[model samples]
Target: MDINNTLTIDGAIKEFAPQIEKTSPLGWSWITFLSVLVLFGFYGLYTQIAEGHIVTGMRDNVVWGIYIVNFIFFMGVSYAGALISGTLHLFRSEWRKPVIRMAEWITIISLLIGPLYILLCIGRLDKLHNIALFGRIQSPITWDVIAISTDIVGCIIFLYMALLRDFAHLRDYPELKVPKWKKKLYYYFALKYHDTPEQRKKLNRTVDIMAAMVIAIAIIVYSVLAWIFSVTLQPGWHSTIFGPYFVIAAVYSGTAVLIVSMYLFRKVYKLEHVITELHFKNMGIILLVLGAFFGYFTFSEYLTKWYGSQKNDELLISILFDKYYWEFVISNYIGVLLPLIIIGIPKFRTIKSITFTSLVVILALWLNRYLIVVPTLESPYLPIQDSRSAWVDYGGTWVEWSLTLGGIAGFLLLFTLASKLVPIVQLSALVKKDKSEENRKSE
Candidate 1:
């Protein structure tokens, strides 16, 4: 077998750039609709930020609202695109060629929006900025700020570097008729790839350096965020496994997010040829592995709490299994278990079915996130100090709902616009001078 024939994950993702805009129009309208909604979400967010966090449901105790959850989720999701895309690229995963562009772009855009949630939560621009100007070195919050900022820079650079070859293709192909601004962006992004023997060597070396940087940034960002929780005195949040647990959970949720994205892209862009059943099937395998990993973490977490016989842990556990068992168990089983079984089946391996399962699993995971986050705040010590008249429920008010939907809509909108503006798949690099069989395979 040829040495290059074996293929690794990153090598596969390199294929995406050339074919990005080549697909049919499947997702355009939906993405357009969501883009408009994102505009609305931002409008609302702007007003809320101006008015203050008082406009939302978050009281003193419930400072961590849905926005925080979404923020963390977004940050976690960013990890998948950053680490998965860049990490695989560093090692050269052949199957990763098609997906890495989406993953990388997804991370860049996701990280950009993530900070907004925290800003909204704080609702004080002056106070937030003060932290930067006079931020304490020792605070986890400070570390989080530094970590995410560094991550954002790294993601943008890594994504731009990955786009280089694709930009060259767009420049070469007249049929694409890529606009002037886009061409300009592509030119800069391409960073003058002459594809010379020495230049190619330097390009590869540069990509390697960026890959390492991206991976380190992803790790540091997530670890710092986890520290934000573990540093707190909270019962469930404080744990040693919280670091890797956060990373694994981030990848798990992030993959589900990518699947949601894939479904939309396949539908909107009509990339049915590029994004095949094999893609979803491979993602299912990843989700299942993470599912198992999450399961073990959950088991160990609960077992330790049970063994320690902590009152706070028992109280929280009792509240969960006894009262919120319906959503809780359903979310876990359907989100975690059902996908594993579906993917394991030979007949269910088709893309259509796998896509369906991915949606189900994704929805279940969303509910699971709600269960994981909201319940803890609800079951706080001292019986939720909120008066009976106050909003103590683990849900968003109308404003929160509008705003949350708006945030989600914004994410979709950015994704849609980016895919349209540039080749979402990174087509140029993936077109092999030879090894045509390398295309369409999943990592």
Candidate 2:
């Protein structure tokens, strides 16, 4: 397959360059809306910092409140970036070309925002640096700090490497009508990339190596986060399966996230040809498999406890199934069942339906995490002998809710800006993948 037959370098520029060169009023409005949410989040942060932790609903019994939930959720969702891009690239899947760049961007943005929740959870922000200075080697917190730092660096390097060829393409292509400043920006990041045969071979090898490392690091980092919870004597979390369980759940939710993103970008950019029905169907199948697996993990986790009937474990299960009955049913039963049914049915596998299913899965997974954290804390092995009603009730306060909204808004804002800076789709990779596929079919 000739390069021109699969994808003319200039033709790709003609098609995708305008995406970066042009801006819509709707884009501005969306950015403005996200900015408002960020401002509100900042106000909530200020109030919490000024008023102290007392303003929030957290108490001695439920010391870990919504902030911890946000931390876990953000960290978990961040897995979508590396796991999707790294896995798809390693597998040499051609369909991944249209979406991998966006996936990598999500990884960088989510990783940056994930740690902010930890900052929010800390009572004393001024002493945050001291953790690195005097952190004990024995503490899981220290391990988490190291893992997160390492993963972020790895993600950034991998993303930059992926972007190099694309950046060079944008820099050299004149038909894109790119402004002078943008051309210079591209030129700077492109690093004199001239698409030489030697350069291409070197870059491909580098990307292949980085993709493998990212996949390994992604699995290890999330498992480390899970260990922080499981290592404790907490009844619900103390299990041998928590590590793989967290990794699976992350992939499950992260894939759902990637589906949602693909839908939005495809629809908005009028990229019906670039991201097609086949992409959605393939991703839907992946989602279906993960949903079933997650269901199995859920059943196994609780079933083990139910059979043993340990008093504390039973109490925690009761809190989950009895007290939080609706949440339990919704997240586990409805959440799992709906996706399976919709995806399993060929008639219902439309882009809109798949996107709808992703929204449900994302929200339900967040609720699942909430159930995991709060219920365990509520039913400590030693009963809450306290007389105070506040000690028993652990509903999150308005400040926490506001900050949560802010986090969501901040994530979207970063994504929006990044999209404008670079073509969300990797034209370079798409062309190369298409050429390879064409060659294979001919052979």
Candidate 3:
């Protein structure tokens, strides 16, 4: 074998496989911790199911609660997977290699867990099938259903296609001590991908086509989610810019979560060489731009309503500016400002700071979603005639809080198991990239 090819193949089998082939003590502890949280989440779900929606803080006035908030957050995070992977592939960005597999994992895991919030929101599991049976084109909910379903299929295809080469690598590397069942699984997933020049060309072409398709599909899917809110007559949600606003926010939060994940994996796997400062800088820059876009949208959204002074819009604005003043300011202003400072100021742009900023942005964006959903519902144009205190204010109950944490745990659990099952970095893609760079340098 040629020296370069030998090195690439050796690295794939030795470096990448060892990282994934076994679980560490820390890994087991992490899984157990997440499992405990999931159990708590299931218990909360049981109470909500047995006792009804009353266990949640949602009322007739404020119908949507933390469940809807979490649904939006998870769905938004899923975009990080599609957008980052698709954009990097399209541009052929060198920085994307270290993080691409993690991005896809985030997307797959988020998609799997995000919809559970909807199930929680539904209150009655038996009526779930009614969505498909009675869904109409006129409803934004119907549009969301179709969009999520389509995106899930598209994401799975992209993820599987991306995994094929890694599967093939693991299959051929018999010394890796992988279980017999896992070896068989890898063989099946690899689809008998024996590495030949012709097969390699076909794989590249297919990935390119799918990458383009997924980018478009992911954008539309998230936009449809925004439309689910904007199409409504609610004061805060009824805006033409809501689609772009949502898409931007999704990318923002998704990127933040990606950075956080990148930091954790880098430390745990000791991939200092593979995931370096340059990747953090590039992703941080992207986050900076997104944070700016988010700030602009936030300003525009409130500025328009503040200018118009429409009674309903004004009331909604008051709730955001006055009642939920701290949350709005923190999630919007502080959230955007902190990241901007961390990324823009050259001195503060360390991996640790970037990851910290990302954590803040992720949490703040969740609060932003909560503010978007609840406060608007509280200040309906028609005054609250029910005269119930609970109907006036909606604070999430223990059941909602527990289930929210559970959903988060579930997302973490999926990602953890996935990391163990496959190479968290796409070794084949990295090899091809390295070879391309070498060829260019030689030329």
Candidate 4:
């Protein structure tokens, strides 16, 4: 058996590309499903905008609710794609090469969805313009918009530049069997890429510069989210350590998402060998380390509050321990503890086990987020003396649920569609063998 045939980038790309061309029942089913979900999400968003945020749980005091939390979580998850890709690419890790494209796009697409959701939650779309006009440079929300946008732009540039080589291959190669427009795209991007001594040097330098910028910008963006909560004067949120705490949690969840996405893509595209059991095992270890760190942060955040015994802290901590204790315990156990233990064990560290563990961690992270947003506002410093007590801790309504589901589906759908467009995995090294040869000749 030719391992090269099974393991090669050309082979995987060739096979995966046909997934788009498939006109069969299941292929149509995915198209139909994605379309319906997106439409439903879009309609829900429109209705939401029409009715205003008042229909949702958000109110005067608790202006930032699930939407903001979701924004932060999505941004963090994108970081998995951005930072992990950037770090691995920078270090020249071979394991990262096959997956970096996936990582980079996930960051870009999720970053886009995250901001839209924030806008949706913000209700009045008209005032968004006012943000720029009166937008205080010092505001965390303004900083968030700027940082996330900059990071998204950086990720896109990095992704497009990296994929340029593969596009060149599709343009030049015989087997690609592509259309005129696609051929045009290949030729178009190929212009920036000649395998000359000068061009190769320029390409390498550009990739390095963009990769470095992505890392710096991603870090700043993560810090921007941390500042969202820390900049506030709330007890659990006000700690100096809050910024780093939020960043760690973001990475922990973001990495879990990448694991889940990678696992899904392997199955969906049947690129099992390319994705491999080893990738799962290695990433599982990464998650295990992150879970441990998350556990530490969780312990520290709660412990300091309970120990300090300030009046508000005391109220919130007691309520958390006693009243909201169930959500508290379950989120920790399934999200953090299970993954940590399962991944830590040699026996359970297989691909299937890791995938299952990753789902648990991701779910827990979602629950963890909901708990954080709802409980803090529920236990505000002032007591809720109102007939509409339930409104105080606004659980997500169906519209919110539909919108959120639609957004998540949209992210996954983008992956599926994106896989069909460019080299889902970069193949420039093989296709560009000619370029490399030309560069050598020029040298």
**lDDT, candidates in the order shown:** 0.71, 0.86, 0.87, 0.74
Residues 225-329, model 1: lDDT tens digits: 988887776667777887887787778777877777777777665567666666777777877788788767767877797788788777777877887787767
Q: lDDT of model 2 at residue 324? A: 93
Worst 10 residues of 4 by lDDT: 1-10
Please give the distance, in angstroms, between residue 34's alpha carbon in candidate 4 and its true position after superposition.
2.0
Report the candidate with higher lDDT, 2 versus 4. Answer: 2
Q: In terms of lDDT, which candidate is stronger, 1 or 3? A: 3
| Clash count per candidate | 29, 0, 0, 0
What's the C-alpha lDDT at position 279 in model 2?
85
Question: Which of the numbered candidates is closest to the native, going by highest TM-score?
Answer: 3
lDDT of 3 by residue, 1-443 (tens): 21222346546568777677788888889999999999999999889888999889998889898999999999999986788898898798766877899998998899989987988888668888988998788998998899998989989999999999888878777688878889899989999886666887998898888889888988899899999889888899999999899989999999999999999988988888788888899999999999999999999998998999999999988888898999998899999999889899999999999999999999899999999999998888777775598787899999999999999999898888898888788777667444432443366
**Candidate 1: misplaced stretches above 4 Å?**
1-28, 382-394, 434-443
Q: Write the per-residue lDDT of candidate 2 for residues 47-76, one digit (tens) a residue.
A: 999999988888878888888888888777
Give the higher-lDDT candidate: 1 or 2: 2
Clashing pairs in 3: none
In model 2, where is the ten-residue run with the lowest total lDDT? 432-441
- For the record, the alpha-carbon RMSD of candidate 3 to the native fold, in angstroms, is 3.9
lDDT tens per residue, model 4, 173-209: 5566556776777788777565557876888899888
Q: Which candidate, 1 or 3, would have the higher TM-score against the true structure?
A: 3
